[model samples]
Target chain A: MYRAQVRVRYFEKKAYDLFLQNLVKGTSHLAIGQEAIAAGVAAALRPDDYVFATYRGHAHAILRGAPMAAVLAELLGRQSGLMAGKGGSMHLTYAAGNFLGSYAIVGAHLTIANGAAWSARYRGTDQVAVAFFGDGATNIGAFHEALNLAATWKLPVLFICENNLYMEYTPIATVTAVARPAADRASAYGLAPIVVDGNDADAVYEVALAAVARARSGEGPSLVEAVTYRHGGHSRADPGKYRPDEEVAEWLAKDPLPRYRERLLASGANPAVLDRIEAEAHDEVEQASLAAQGAPLADPAELERQVFADGGATWRR
Target chain B: MATLTQVATRTVTYREAVALGLAQEMGRDPTVVLIGEDVAAAGGVFKATAGLLERFGPERVRDTPISEQAILGAAMGAAMTGLRPVAELMFADFLSVAHDIVANQVAKARYMTNGQLSVPLVVRFGNGAGLRFGAQHSQSVESWLMAVPGLKVVVPSTPADVVGLLAAAVRDDDPVMFLEEKALYPMNGEVPSGEHVDQLGVARVRRHGKDATIVSLGTMVHRSLEAAAQLATEGVECEVVDLRSLVPLDVTTVAASVTKTGRMFTVEENPRLCGWGAELASIIGEECFYDLDAPVRRITSPHVPVPAAGSLEDAMLPSAERVADVVRRALG
Candidate 1:
């Protein structure tokens, strides 16, 4: 499982970098640091379990088994993307993987996880849903409401907040006046909270295993806050003026992916094997990037297709 | 068409009718389940889902926390996972809280997934201002949802339509917003028992009068029928069309009605400007332009916040008198 995490991490980074390469315009938020949460959560999930994320969702999408080409195409706004380019970065979906969507709205997809969990329980499916959001999302109203509902209903959902400290440059301390860490907000919902080193893939994997187990057993929802930091600014172009130089250096020393690689190499796991894994993932991502560039564009004329359940509204006029 | 009794006659309140539809659907199909605030115990504030908790237990008849967004979103999640979920937004006015989940998640999941995942999910809620539930509680916000893509809005007028639309919503491979008028929960109608899958976009020709067609839905359907009866005695026969579902609009029915009658009027209790009536008027006026003897008229409530006082409510809302007046002017 640990080795699988490293391979997925490499795949995610390679895929994301390739997606960035194919970008015609706009920015991309790379999950370079938060790879463990996706891999760990994916490891704990079954094919029927559902997952949702926000705009910074590439890692989750890739780890959940969305084809590299499909996701890259989405980021590139190509027709072959997960959502056929309709959703772009935020709304990519791989339904067959039980991946519902990557909502653009902050703290928006939690409600979806709650809804799906209730449904799974009703159908007697041991399927659970995983909602991945940023620590910044914890302060949002939907976050509070979603956790409360999940706890109250005992819905099978694992609410994971990748607490990277800042919500688009607004530091966590400024928004949530709560005295302790924001992950403790889960406690108010009467849900058991597990705060782990998000940079450590094994730690995330263990916490995710427990949460997914509880959810599948119909016990209820749980919250897991993976504390990590992003190496770059919130989005592209903004040079992250908010963080002090020392803080960036401090977090860089704790980079999760590199630390995992070092540990694997120290354990005598052949460095060549790790290099081979990187090569394969890198090659796959490069191919996907090429594919994204050549992917089709949605026909401009079919813009109104599938907008409504019965298509666009029609009247006498 | 089918004999009224044979069609499906159940003496059920609108609330009971909807609940029974959900219970029956959930029982018959394991994929179906309930997700809402108080749907499990307290059997919904309207008591539609009474006895659901004990019968289905907590897992199936799930009670969600007071987060409409989460309720709607969870329903989307569950649906994508292959469970057909029926979520209740206790009041239609509260759909605003869960708008993104319903509009973006549940609505677009299937289409975005290239139809790989079908959101067999229904968001059931009550909308209207008659309950004196104050401004926050009494809003017919269905117009907001009708504008969103990938959503099928169903407003059932009769108890029969409630059963039929809801059953179809649960069984159909799509996302449906099922709106019930809060004031009309007690109104009874015949619901033919078997084969309840009524096509959603087909508006019913409730009364087949020839002078002009009055398009209405939910409570307004009853008001239109009453207006039609009163107008009939005055030799001004008015055809009333019940738009059971708003999104998959049976514009064909409205088109045929306007073509035959040469005039059309839209009636609803929702505020006048930018209301569903306005959309209906736009569609009708555009499609049946050559057939119209006069411009389409819309008889709707005044464009103002809902008044809390009962007397003011009646005055502010569209009444049978207003519908008749609109028809009279349209005919002239």
Candidate 2:
């Protein structure tokens, strides 16, 4: 879990640098401080379990065992990326890894996740699907509709809301009516909603593991609201001036990586082991960045190939 | 070379033909599932899915809540993961609620996934504006959907065409919008029995003539045929073409007819500002400019919401007489 968090930090930093250099075009939403939830939730799931996440989902894809090189190549719009450069940062789907999709549209991913779970129930499979979104998505109509459908059908779905306290620049309190969004709506949908400190990766994994078991055992859906914070602005463009400096400092002190390192050290873990783990993650990310830098751009001639599967696409004269 | 083929046929309403087509596809393919409001026990609002729930059971035929976004979103997700889902929106006007899912998710997912994913999903909705169902319930929004690149739109006019085109839509490996004209559901015609799949993007020449060509789709096809018959009495031999498929439009067939007749008339139930009639007129002008003796003409609904009053609604929509008048103008 510590290695996963550190790798995400280093990977996103390089991505930000690449964006500054204009190597990576378009905006990217980075999950710098919210790595613990991604690592912990992913660790709790089986290999075949499906994951549908929001646009800020690089860490989720990486923790789900997507190759870093391909992910970096995707951000660089290279042909060898996860989506063959067609989907940049916002839209990524790793079919083999069971990372169904990372959609930019808020609350849209929830319905698709519910459908995956519904399909699983229809096919009589034990597979469970999870949808990861932010606090802002909870207020969307589709989110409530998905919850209602999942509860009524007893679908094997896990709704994960990483409540970072803010939706873009505005605080959750400003936009939402309820104080605890997920918990307040849980009873209306007749599903158990669990809230946890997202900074503590261990607590998140424990709760998520129990939820996964419940879903696989046909106990229906559950909502897990992990209270975390985003250390950066919504996108790379914003400077995060809207947030109070004191609040930012307080959250920075509660950074998950160093806290996890302290927990590992106090448990009498070898100091060299932690050092080597951190060094290896840095090396891996460095190698991935170099590989992505050398990757080739997508071919323009086949731009219309994937538009339709049957290959009947016609260009207008 | 010439060939003769014979197939068994029976007369049925457009509703029965559509329902039969769905049932046959469901029986043939296990992955095909029906999802919509009142599609299961109630058998759909228009009864287009009548008797399907009893045959397929509740598992395949699901009656979802009145949520268009969820319906379309779930269909997209299910289709991505090996299920060929045929979802229904109660009304074509309600497509606005499922707009993002249909346009952003369903249409773009295949291309965004770089061929790694295929959304073999079909969304069926009732279109056209002659029902006096008001502006919200009635609309011919095919032109709005055609602007979207990844979607294949089909407008079947007759009972036989509905059965054949719907079967083909379910089997097609892409997102297809099957727009059914609400007024034509009770209209009766002969449909071929057993398994039948019509080739999409192929326009059929309904009536052969020599003076002018009349291109139309959905309800307008019948109106064009009627107009052609009326023109025939006045020594104006008009060729009528039924465009069953809208996306991969059969420009070649329309061009051939226009070249032969040297005049063209395109009709649609949608408004004239930016309707499918304008597209047909442009295609004909671009492809058969030199072959045409006169400029192509378009007969379309007025640029206003369909009125609730029956008389006003009748006046707004294009009819056989209006189409014939346009043909006469094109000939002159």
Worst 10 residues of 2 chain A by lDDT: A308-317
Off by over 4 Å in 2: A315-317, B1-5
Worst 10 residues of 1 chain A by lDDT: A308-317
| Candidate with best DockQ | 2
lDDT against true structure, model 1: 0.78
RMSD (Cα, Å) of model 1: 2.8
DockQ of 2: 0.59
Per-residue C-alpha lDDT of model 1 across residues B1-332, encoded as one tens digit per residue: 22355453657788788877776787798777786778887899888889888988776787766777767767776777667878889888888777777776677766665555667788888888787777788898878888777777889888777877788878776788888899999887666766465667788999997888889988988889988998998899888999888877788888899899988888888887788888878877777789998888888888888878889888877788888877776665
Q: What is the TM-score of each candidate against the true structure?
A: 0.92, 0.97
Give model 2's share of reference contacts. Answer: 0.49
